[model samples]
Target: MSAPSTDLTQEKQRFELLSQEFENSQKDYSKFIAARQQLEAQLQENKIVQDEFALLKSDAKIYKLTGPVLLPQDKAEATLNVDKRLEFIRGEIKRAETQIADCQKSLESKREELLTLRMKIQGV
Candidate 1:
């Protein structure tokens, strides 16, 4: 009876410890998921900005050439304006690309953290 009682006590303690560890892992995973979602949103925003920039670049090219062909002097000024806009868009695209790279790094880090936690929990 004593042996049985001791075994039961040890089992209960082990169970409790395991439960606590599972809870902690759950919390950490939750946080990681949230961060991943935010990173995904930012990536999406970056993609949208990139798309917008591409469209703006296309518009600038079209207008710059058409303006010059149709109305030389007026088109020259318009082309200059379009060129300026294109330059601005290019700069914005570069910035967005940089941000995307940063987000990817953060996402990878979070994934690695989650994987490490899971492996630790599994006793691997």
Candidate 2:
């Protein structure tokens, strides 16, 4: 093969590889976005739980959901559990956001490379 044909083949291979990487990254970002949304929903529900627990009287009756049964549970402990869950969800949200940002940066960079490669191929 001529030098130019060989170079073109290599560039074409690189272009396909980069395209696949872009698609994979896009899928990862989509998954993270869905996870973040789910976490946000859980956080909202947990907030409602926190509010409900806060409004309860110290002596008010509460129940823990044991499978097939509502077992009596301390109000304070339940409130604390809900608070912990909310904090955990908040941390997850922050992490997910960070991952999303990184993924976006990678995606954009790969896109620019793809565009350059396309132009290169066309010029050849």
> Which candidate has the highest TM-score of all?
2
Model 1, range 39-122, lDDT digits (tens) per residue? Answer: 556556655644554565433533223644743334345546646655665565566556556655655665665566555545
Any runs in candidate 2 off by more than 4 Å, and if so which?
none
Clashing residue pairs, backbone N/CA/C < 3 A, model 1: none
Which regions of candidate 1 are displaced past 4 Å? 58-124
lDDT of each: 0.56, 0.94
Candidate 2 per-residue lDDT over residues 1-36, each given as its tens digit: 599999999999999999999999999999999999
Q: How many backbone clashes does candidate 1 have?
A: 0
TM-score of each: 0.47, 0.96
User: Every model's Cα RMSD, please?
Assistant: 11.6, 1.2
